[model samples]
Target: MTPNAASPLPPPAERRRLRESGSLTQDQLAKRLGIPSRTVNAWESGRTTPRGRKRKSYAALLAELSRSAAKVTVSLEKRPAAPEPAPAAAPLTPAQTFDALYAFCAPALVRQAYLLCGQRELARESVERAFQLAWQRWPEVAVDRDPAGWVRASAYEYALSPWHRFRPSHRHPEPPPPDADDRALMDVLLKLPPPYRRTLLLYDGVGLDLPETAAETEASTPATAGRLLHARETIARRLPELADPSVLHRRLAELASVERLNAPRPPAVRTGGERRSRFWTRAAIAFTVALIGTTTFTLRTAPTHYEAPVPAGVQVQGVPPRVALGPLSEAETQLRTKLRQAAAHGPERLLPVFR
Candidate 1:
């Protein structure tokens, strides 16, 4: 039997040709697609496939680019051909890969989580959990084309879990007393839909390039750009001071920096041993409960004896009323018999002399 070879979806050559036809570099195409430049490179190099919705979107985008290219064929004829993509980098050691990633990305991910969850502890928990998962699956993650992106996506998902919403300890942190304009901007930003808010945060707050922002938000570059634009316009209407894009970006960066600085230390990652210990602890509790239940049921169904209580004033008789006491010995019995005989015979002739 032979192993199956992995093939790129939508075909790598076609993707490259479509991108080249549009006179777009890998970075430019990545921005348009709302993904990382590395991701675009992977697609063109046949290292991976675009699946699900991404696959459909990639196909549609490629077709559109091709059509647009056809309309301007004359103008594009003089451009130089794109160079062939380089080969994939060798895989990094799991420890080195994970350590580097954690050092570089932990703070940013924590801030992102905090912004989404609005609770200090929950945000830290979300980032810790994400990193723990990445560590556990280091073999896969270390080799992944975009490990940072993978971690970011995982952290975002964890932060958005519904469990966080209902937690008793979850509470919004108090903002530093802001001036009127800052307060208004915050109010409007908080009201924006999650997608727009996240897009703006990644683009402006984190200073990610358009393509990187899209990659983080799982949106296309164009869509991410549109979201950023809309969010800015919305903010501008509420606070005219942020009307300039540069001012808004700077403000967002400052806010993100503050959040990062204020974020609590990341929670300790649970080791495999710790996770096993937790599982066993829970199992022991469950077993104890079951044992108690079975014992209680057995006791409830067991037969019991009941006795009647005596009446308050009634004297109970032990022996029958007509019955006489028995003699204590054989001699006593014989003597009593003789005495009775004598009494029967002498009843007529009884003359008594007292002594």
Candidate 2:
């Protein structure tokens, strides 16, 4: 029945905006309000909200910040026309839009990927590859409901692909996490099946609701929930300290934070994607041309008529092989020669040379 408690505070984005505009770090705000920074993060991330006295303090702080931002906005609007008004900014082109998306989502996706696959290089590579794919399919992705989720799914799939283990670079294991506990936690995570691992990350680490996690994992809600529970239980059995979801969430985040992962620049990713696209495109054209050429050569060189193969020679059962004949007797030979000389109209030369 209190006024501050009765009124709703800003939405998640606005709360973050107000805090940022007020020039207060989450740590500073938490210190001033005597709350954990994690709680502040959760609220800003829309994962949780403060309650009781903390809610009131947080709400009042945001309202003051909002009012101050409003005054600044008004003053700026009133004072700001240049001698010549500036031209309106142009809308972002697809490339610019794609680049912006990459810059915004790549870092966090890389960290998420690290948690999905323990290899640091693979984690970074997967995100970059995902962004590349997004750029290639920019039109589709731009119109997507959740572009970040799309990119995240791509990255996670790549990082967790069974094929990656067979890769030359992954033939040997990378160095283990510096902290023994982190290494153990990572090993435990890696031990879980990919579906369960992804489910846990989507639900616990990324804060997706069960249905969303299920949809993303392409599983029924029940199946997704089961996987999540099983994954958590397995981890807890190995690492009892992470039995609680909240602690596990925080620990997973900490694990990601400790890695030295950095994604390539957006322009580089875009360029790489374009180059890859061109390579494939050209390769396709080349393949088509070669196929056409091969087809033409085949058509030209192929036999027009089907020539039946010769049958194998076989002996006739009813007949014997003929004996070799000797030359005719001398008189017989002479008679045959005389007959040929007297033959028909003329000799062989006058016979029209049939050839």
| Tens-digit lDDT track of model 2 for 289-338 | 99999999999999999999999999779787789988899999999999
Candidate 1 lDDT over residue span 1-355, tens digit each: 2212332234678789888878898768767777656567667877667776666677778878878978788666756677567798988765665667777898877876766655557777777778888877777987799888888888878877767656666655546325564455566776888788778777666556777778777788899889989988898888888887667766764554554434333233536424855788999999999999999999998867775787689666885687687757988889888877874345677656699
Highest TM-score, which number? 2
TM agreement with the true structure for every prediction:
0.48, 0.70
Candidate 2 segments exceeding 4 Å error: 1-51, 54-86, 306-355
lDDT of each: 0.71, 0.88
Q: What's the C-alpha lDDT at position 235 in model 1?
A: 85
Error of 2 at 47 (Å): 10
Residue-level error in angstroms, candidate 2, position 174: 0.6
At residue 238, what lDDT does model 2 achieve?
95
